[model samples]
Target: MTHRGAEPPDGTGFLAVRCDVTDSRQVDRAFEEAEAAHGPVTVLIANAGVTHDRLLPLMREEDFTSVVDTNLTGAFRVARRAARGMLRVGHGRIVLVSSTAALHGAAGQSNYAAAKAGLVGLARSLTREFGPRDITCNVVAPGLTDTDMARALTPEQQSELLRRTPAGRAAHPDEVAEAVAFLAGAGYVRGAVIPVDGGAGLGH
Candidate 1:
């Protein structure tokens, strides 16, 4: 696990530590450091995910399994660790960052879609388990966004996607972040899948 940023000044109230979510040891250590610096963790954003897109037939077993392990199981790892402190504190927020692909599906992204779809179940389950403790678990699913990942699409692919999107464009990363922020403050919002897509996956 490696991070490339310096810590904030003493009173800036922020810390970004290197954490490999797929590795439980690293996850635990990251939280330990956070708890020591701050107080008990009251909010958790399980947003670590990766994608390895390949047609189902040509996709290697490792590709499929690794995507699931990191995207789905990794969210589980971080949330589980955070929940311990949240439960003791008796209040918390857990927002899982998912994708529109999980709702509408995408060709050559079976593994990614599957892993993201799993987050919905994970969030809902956690809500049921932790609601009594005042811990809300929810999912924020974003569609194609104007990020480096979107910039990699071929011209034709990009054009087709934009044409299909109801908003006639990809989303801005800040739009998705805004949705996550809303959920963070919404203590009553639990087990919900909030779509940050520009109506791309509207029906679902």
Candidate 2:
């Protein structure tokens, strides 16, 4: 999962490893390591994702499956494990990072859209299962953020995004982070998909 990209903390508290979220073993290791040190995950942010933006006819089978596995099922892997701990502790938070494509269709992004859309269902299911235990689950869908991943757009593509988006520009990564932060900390929000799309995905 992507973080703030800031350097590691000077205090050297928790150990964060580079893990492929789709791989169950790696997901397990992340929890094990974090638990071995700090504690069972009290809060989880399922932000793992990937994109394979080829047209459907040209997109490889692996491209499609990989996106689903990483972006959707990967969140499940962490949630299932973390739920066990959260259940035992009786309180937790889970924020699944989705995308505006989950609600709005986009050309050449079928795989991404499907995976992201699935997160909404996942979040809702978690809320139903865990909300009574005080474990809130929600989704945060970010729009076109001005990160390296978004800047990959061609000039025309970027221009089209600006024109279509009521905000008139792409969002900053920090803005998306703020959405995640609020829902993660809020006490009542559950099974909601908070969009940080600057009105690009409004009315969806």
Model 2 alpha-carbon miss at residue 142, Å: 0.6
User: Which parts of model 2 have CA positions greater than 4 angstroms off?
Assistant: 1-14
lDDT, candidate 1, 145-164, per-residue tens: 89877787678867877777
Q: Give the TM-score of candidate 2.
A: 0.91
Please tell me which predicted candidate would have the highest lDDT against the true structure: 1
Query: What TM-score does each of the candidates earn?
Result: 0.92, 0.91
Candidate 2, residues 1-204, lDDT tens digits: the string is: 323235545556556565667778877877887787777788889987778888999999998999999899998998998888888888898999999888987788899999999999999987887756789999999888988768776788778777879988899888999998898798799999998888987666
- How accurate locally is residue 122 in candidate 2, as Cα lDDT from 0 to 100? 96
